[model samples]
Target: MPLALLALAISAFGIGTTEFVIMGLLPDVAADLHTSVLTAGNLVSAYAIGVVVGAPLLAVVGVRMSRKHLLIVVMGVFVAGNLLSALAPDFGWLVAGRVIAGLPHGAFFGAGSVVAASLAREGREGRAVATVLLGLTFANIVGVPAATLLGQDVGWRATFLVVTGIGVVAVSALAALVPYEPARPQQSLGRELRAFRDRRVLLVLATAVFGFAGVFATYAYLASIATHVMGLEESSVVWVLALCGVGMTIGVAAAGPLTDRAALPTAYAGLGGLAAVLIAFAFTAHITWVAMVMVVLLGAVGFLMTAPLQTMVIRFASDAPTLAAASNHSAFNLANAGGVWLGGVAIASGWGWTSCALVGACLAIVGLVIALTAGQTAARRATA
Candidate 1:
């Protein structure tokens, strides 16, 4: 691996930490802002909206800039957002800060992926992308739990300040390590839009939107599941959270080689695995040890699509990889919003917290069907 990958991974770590750490601190944020947990969750939705809107927006404008410069600019945006969050006066400002912070989240990853893929050896494309995403997986395991604990002790505001500090370090590392490349021939915005017109591209993105949603719906309320459903002390939730992160790290690391060898098949298998795990979780939540194991499984299966989905999108849009790549991030965060909303409705409709797993299961199955259809369609085209 190139040392430049280390820079990108560090930036990914900072970005992922800011993205997920809020989930663990949701209860604290709600209490401090004099609001309900549900309302704090709305802030999460706000951030997702920012990601959905910003990914393509930034990518289109940034198509002409060097990836290194673009990465720096977005990291700057992240730092500024965290600073705003740390200084937020109340619920409204905090929501605004989240939105601001989220605006750069997807664009950074999109650009970083393109850069990482460009840097990889001929047969190792998937490994490079996975290396970048590892930062995100590790953030779940180490960063979120640590930040959550820090928030519980110091204050949620202080936690954002800490994230801001991480962002600063990432910015420095990125500037020093990521080499500059001249901008490639620019694709027109219309050419970029054409990527969306391809049915295969649309299907692949749809799969991500639905498939990824399954996990987010369940994860959106994980804190509730930990404390209210499992009857664990609030402090112990951090360990379970870390355990899930461990599962994600392992799963994503495994996904790289699997994706390099078999992209869509791996995707189908992963989607099926997610559905099975969620279905099992619905029945197992009553047992503490069983539920703990399920958390790891859920994280593992849920993230299996992370690199494959990106690869599939880039494959289809070879003419406009950056735009297609950035748009996939939009797909991901849209799933985040959609899943959170569906999970909230399920819980509010008198379904127990465990029922979110059922919701996730259904979504995963739907995504599996889509992946299978795409694979079959491509096979037919190849045979014909």
Candidate 2:
């Protein structure tokens, strides 16, 4: 892989860290900002909303800009947002800061994926894209855990400050490493907008929304599961999370090659595996060791679909990939928000915490059905 891909991965790492580390710091932020934990949870929602809004918005607004320059500009936005979060005086200001920070999340990944694909050798584009995303998995492994620990040891503000520093490094790396590509004169708002009209593109995105939601449904409350369901101590929650991260890393590593060989089959296997694992987790949560293994499997099967889904969207929207690729993240964020809400509802409705796994299993099944439909539709279209 080119060193340029490393820069993209670093950018992804910083973005992933900032996005997830907040979950662990919500209690600290609530106490420090004089708000309820429920209210502080809005910080997560604020970031997701920013991603859903900013992905397409920034991709379109910067359609005329070179991918390299656009990446630098968005990473700059990321830096500013984190800096603001680090310095915010009140809860409202912090929420604003999170939104600002999130605004560049999808745009960066969207542009970065294009850049990574452009840098790859023939038939290796899937791995190249997966390489860029490896940073996200690594963030789960290293960045979030370390940042969470720092927040607990120091303060939540200090954690944001560290993330701001990471953002700075990312911006610098993007500027120095990513090669300059002149803007494509053929690209326009109308052309990019048209990609969304394609049924195939929409189906791939839909797969992301429903399939990935299954991952988040259980993930959103993993700590609670470890404590309330698995009967693990509070201190072990971090280890459980780290174990999940390990699974994520393995999943991404495996996804690249599988996607390169057969994107649709990879998606089929991923979504199918995800459904089975989630159903199993519903029961495994009763056993500590078994639950730990399930957490790892859950992460693996859940993320295994990411590369295939992303590659499919890009392939289907070949003429206008940036916007479509960016919108994929928007869809995933929607899943994140929706899955968490559904999981919470299941718990509130007198179902056990393990019931969230069942909910996730159901969502995965729906996503699988969509994927199957899409595959059949594509086959018929190809033959026609």
Error of 1 at 85 (Å): 0.6
Where does model 2 exceed 4 Å of error? none
What lDDT does each candidate get? 0.87, 0.92
The number of the candidate with the highest lDDT is 2
Model 1 spans with C-alpha error above 4 angstroms: 381-384
TM-score of each: 0.96, 0.99
RMSD of each: 1.5, 0.8
Instruction: Kindly list the per-residue Cα lDDT of model 2 for residues 216-326, writing each as its tens digit.
Output: 999999999999989989988888888898898899899999989998999999899999999999988989889999999999999999888888888888898999999
lDDT of 1 by residue, 13-94 (tens): 8878888888878889999889998789787777888899889888888878888998999889999999999999999999
lDDT of 2 at 87: 98
**How far does residue 380 in candidate 1 sit from its true spot (Å)?**
4.0
